[model samples]
Target: MSLLSTQHTLQAYYLGLFGRAADPDGLNYWLSQLESGTLALDDALMLMANSDEFSERLQLPADDDWLAQVYPAYFGRPVDAEGGGYWSSLAAQGVSAPVLLQSIMASATGADREALDATTSIARFYSQQVSPERYDPAQTLIQEGLRSNEALYAELAAMDEQFDALTVMEVGESLEGRPLYSASVGSGPRKLMIVTQQHGDEPTGTEAAMLLLEWLSGDSPEAQWLRSEISLTVMPRVNPDGFERWVQLASGEASPDTTIDPRRNSADIDLNRTWDSSETLDLALIPEALAVRQEIARFQPDLILDYHNQNNYINAAGELETISILWPTNDLIDDQVTATAQQAAVALAQGVAEFDYGFLSLFPGGDTPQIARNGLAIDGVPTLLIEQRGLEEMELIAYEGLAVNYNALSSALILEGLMSMIGVITELGSGGLTDIDPALALQIPDRGERIQYQDIYTLSDERIDKEGMPTETELQPEVVGVSAAVLDDALAA
Candidate 1:
């Protein structure tokens, strides 16, 4: 084949294996071996084509290091080693290659590189082939699409008629003077707030929120009821500057060629950690956080949802543990909300399963209490934190294959379910507050197989042995007294 044809074939092959490049290093090695005449490309392709190992390696799990190496090459840019990993960029783009690759590899296989390449090329050609009669030139569909800030803003400007009822509130200016946009809709007495992109690299939620904004402002009957019954405030892009920086870095247009900085705004402070506390050195260091805080204080939303992505689990707040239908406050209303969210999650899990994606609820941790959910709960606004698997590690499957839109569709379903239960929200706050039972406290087992209660706390070293087995330590009378005091305070709440 001519060099042009070879390049075209290679591009097609690469596109065909969207989520499948199992053993990227091995693939590269095979390519090198072919170039050096050490191994025939046909033989190498045959090896990959026949092996289950190749298929297994294509699934990029959370701990896999191959993603760090392959993603940069695919994007035609070098990923930062000091920062998290290439998955960060994938999260920003709202797409995972591993999931897509799994689907591609299963569909095409051949003994020769040329044959494999041709098969992939044909596959891509057919996948993108659209009938002229059925295609609409004016219809805007953002399926698996990424747009820069300028392009997005332009699109929003053109679609202003659809968003006429939505009021744009400029909370603050980015370090680069870009006006941060927050959409406020509805005129109901009760206010609900949502913020996305707190970590700029996590853009799936941000995109989902934007899509929701458009849907709400449109003439849907559901939108009309939501507008009349509740006031919703949404901050779509909390870190526009970081988002722009990531875009530039991913596109190979970044100046100075420094590693990608994961922090928000100009000051480089973690916005999530800069909440109301003494550790907050520079309150103005993160203008985005300050702006959000001001908005929360002003609106005092009855409920809030902060969207984020994780490598492992989908989690909700601990506050949703019980049905609060017996309380008379807005915070208790979350029982129905929690139930609705769980039902939606089950549907989402079923959808993701079609693509072989694993789903689980997030574990309760100290970090959860320090962030938005716990902080908002203190102010009486019950919050739900939603987490989805990182985009870089999604499983690939065959039409319902890896390209299955689980995260996007799950988000929509959750929103739909929430809207359905909106009228019963006031009933959630009907439950009365109760103290935690000391008898229900979790017990930790020691290495000696001894059980301990709240009155006997163990130090880190004393808690575990050299082999990571739990260890036992005798508690001093004073220590036991102090533990009792702490437990009493805790249970008395």
Candidate 2:
């Protein structure tokens, strides 16, 4: 057979396995990947993997390092020594490249990690969005995805100690005993405590918080100002166990269909709700909550900011919302605190708008004092909760819907709010965060606060007609386009 004919046959066979015929474009992509190091053929494994570059296919199956092939395919970087050893061990025990790739994709890699290793994922989705000529190895990160706690801590520890204003310490541990860390910056007169991801599954806040850490650690004027004027304490991931649970959910070990949100720790108590609860007050039931509550007592922050993700039932405009800040319910909230938060919220929203970046709004309705934002508010510390967009929706809004990645924009807005709040305290001489405009906060729709938004379904990233059927357009075609029929319906799976 001709070389072209041989390629066509192989492409046809693979597509046939999926109950679909070959698209010439997909076949072309497949063939190009063969040259770009995508493992298109089982027989082409390079046994002597250490060479890094295989001048000629070895045609022998000796040291087939599935890890080597997949590391670059996924992370846009080679496997580290430890990773290479681990996966090479699996390959030595008889795993093939295809099997290893399947396992990697199935494990905790999730959509965000997969987005980085874009060539192997969602070619069809990007075909319309990103130009084929500009294909980079790792195409995306964030967009409703999360960084693993290990990955996050590694990055944090690796940051250079550039200033005395920054200090990293452990505040407490999760129910499963994962160390909870806090990064404290600044020694200013006022204190601002920011806690993120009290609910493990809510990871966008943690990502945004990391950006704040990076910014504050820098030599920028803003960083220097924040360092000298306000003491900032941030616990990026408060619910480590729940965050791990989110990783498990992505890996298919846990199901999102659970009755209670899997964001609960091992004891199955909602971490956010545990605050101020009778049981948690005495460190009775929720140890995780106690750890943070104790810290809050010691910190006595003038303002507390909690970050989170509200997911898709929100973001009604089919665009990435910059952030939604929630103030304490006015009922029991300190008038001064509310004024400060309201002033900060107004400035935060204005900053995002000024950049022409993401849209910012407020939590329109009354606050529920049970959640961490309101729960912490009860302590007389002003509080604001920031809800960033979820994954698929964030991807559409950040990657496809808008200009730059929403993360930088998100980080900036968060920093602005923190700065404004703390700045208010610093200028206490100018009369502290007095007030912005109650009318301004009222302008933001109570879209997410309403109970109806809670009890309903929201559309996924894929295109749907008025009848709600999948349209030709798909945000992640590889993830969703198979027929709805079960693969093995007889098993009731």
TM, every model: 0.47, 0.55
> What are the runs in model 1 whose C-alpha is more than 4 Å off?
1-142, 156-161, 255-260, 277-279, 312-360, 367-370, 391-493
Model 2, span 1-493: residue lDDT tens:
0111334333223321221223435556656767687654543223212223322333212243434544433443445586566666776787654455445444423332322322222222222223334333233311222366776776667653555557887778777788888788777776778788777766656665665566566665545665676777788888888767555544434445562344677787777776454332535457777777777887778777777766532355543344567777747667777776766566556534422234566654456667776666666777777775453333333222221122322333333333333333333322334545645766775543322221322323443222321122221112111111111110111
Query: RMSD in angstroms, all models?
Result: 20.3, 16.5
Model 1 earns a TM-score of: 0.47
Candidate 1 overall Cα lDDT vs. reference?
A: 0.41
Clashes of 1: 24
Q: How far in Å is the alpha carbon of 463 misplaced in model 2? A: 14
Worst 10 residues of 1 by lDDT: 474-483
Q: Model 1: per-residue lDDT, tens digit, 1-493?
A: 1122332333333432333222234334555777788876345544443456545755432432544433322321222363334444443554544443333233322112222332333222222222333222222111222345665455455445457778766777766676666677777766667787676555556655555566556555546655676677887667777767655544334542363453356667566666534344565567787788778887777656666654432113211110011111234234444333333223323222222112233323343334665555544555555554333212111001222122222322222222223322222212211122212212211112112211111212222112321111100011100111111221122
- Misplaced by over 4 Å in model 2 are 1-145, 160-163, 254-260, 277-284, 313-322, 364-367, 391-432, 435-439, 448-493
Q: What are the clashing pairs of model 2?
A: 144-391
| Candidate 1 positional error at 485, Å | 58
| Highest lDDT against the true fold, candidate | 2
